[model samples]
Target: MSSSTQPSDIIIGRTFGALFIGVTIAAVLFGLSCVQSFVYFQTHRDPGTTFYKLVVICLWILDALHLAFIVHCVYYYLVSNYANITAPMDVVWSFKLQILFEVLIIQGVHSLYLYRIWIVSQGRSRILPIIVGIVIMSNSGVAIALIWALYQCSMFSELNKIEWATFLTLGTITFADVVIASSLCYLLATSRTEFSSTNSLITRLMVYIINTGCLTSMCSMAAIITCAVMPTNFIFVAIEFLLAKLYVNSYLALLNARYYTEVNTDTNNSDTFHNRHGVYRPELHVRALDDDELQVSRKDLFKHLDDTVHPSRSVKEPALAVTTEMNSFSSV
Candidate 1:
């Protein structure tokens, strides 16, 4: 092979190799998210709202489809079309399907966060939701247009031909993520109760909001920058492949946190129940409540507490259990 052929080979290898690696990593994450979803549904069967459960299921399906589509793209590029007397490959229909699935995954996750914002704000502000909603919808629209334009382009090398649309779509996604993180952190901070346990839960939630939201936005920014700098290269495509997985994994992480917290809380409650009945652990300060308080659902128990109740006694009563339950509930 000539020297010219070597460079061509390297470029082809790099492009398809990066995609293969990205798809593999994304598939692993998707599989993990599926396991997490299963455990999540089993542990927290009642996600309070049917909508929340539906979101989880939808996200899972979208992520799976995204992974499958990418795998097919890889196979077609590397095997089926391998022998074509090719220059750089053109964006095929499989690639378009991948982009569409990505858009769906992103939009679904964004909607989930928007719902969180509404709940965290106690439905008080219509303004934030409307603003964020517009941004999300606009981003999705631009993304679709970009994909359409991508198909119209004669070659993948001409990605820069639709540069404006590309940047707008990515920039909008990053902006939406920033707005979501800031809104969630601010609202959650303001809603904090003076109770120690509640504060602990809120702190964890805030950390989750920041980590997930920031990481996704940063990935988006990276993709946008890469595309701007090297539109003809597959570098941006490699990064873009990771975005959907990151979003899904982040959302799944938030859900899994609830499950672990519930398990811990249940252990504490069982220990308390056992102690109160037979062997009392004085260090825990667990009090023996009447059957009524015990029978009262965790949701109702919180409503039963008055503002003036002592913190120590409240911890020993149903209050602590309710706190754990509510933390899991509200954080979702």
Candidate 2:
């Protein structure tokens, strides 16, 4: 029935064609999300927002994914780098598979922040500082490894080599991310601390970050599996971009540290004001006490184990709110 390809027949055939439309669309969206998040974080900063710094930390991860996918997209789709895109099906899938884990790492970051916010908001003091170290080590290591793999792949000319190299590396990154991210989630879900609304403002952002990170990980996993098995897909490129965008936009949301908690220490009892993204406001807490109050500033509180006299690791509950000896703010 080769009648110069009838209009109806051509349309039907094209519709059923094996074109990688799904992957292509996803890549574009991921890239845009990353850029959005990146800009969001930079514009948002208030010195008092202690937790927002973590959000800034989140920016680096999203940026990495964005850049990785950018490289992947250029190499696969762009004119000059087109020579690098050749591969059979499953082998080419490694690039997209790798990107999926990268996105998951970003997601894990958001989850960790969310848990912290939840802990602070609830005033649950059970959170130890060491957890931060575990997260930093685990996530950063995988990201570095993945980026290294990408560089290695970039330098190669053959498909088999890229597959052999990236496949194992990506699998390791994914496995590690799942373990640590799950631990963070478990910590948050079981947190018992309950801070007043005074801690609500900034705390809200942290919790929100966690939720966003969770959603991202859940959805990205499915996409990665499909790409890994299918390969030679334009869809992979689009998904990569979209994932990048998600990472970046999430970081941008995190830049709103000022919108959360603001600490004001007076001569007597320290006052805590809990803000919820500049919406619900509350009166400042005023109390009478000695010039010496047990109020810990973010500066005094190291990310984790810096206190030598009473090493926190030894103690189950390390005092983040270290009773300061210095007096900066006077009484009213």
lDDT of 1: 0.69
Tens digit of per-residue lDDT, candidate 1, span 1-332: 11133324546655777778878877888888888788767765643656556777888889889988988888887788776646335556778789889988888888877766555444366787778778878877888888788777755556556878778888988998988888867765765554564556557767887998889999999988887776555777878889999999888887665445445545644344544447545533333243224423332212211112121122244555644544453333
TM-score of 2: 0.42
TM-score of each: 0.78, 0.42
Please give the CA lDDT of all the candidate structures. 0.69, 0.41
RMSD to native, candidate 1? 7.5
Per-structure clash totals for the candidates: 0, 39
Query: TM-score winner among the candidates?
Result: 1
Candidate 1 to truth, TM? 0.78
* Superposed model 2: Cα runs more than 4 Å off: 1-157, 164-207, 255-332
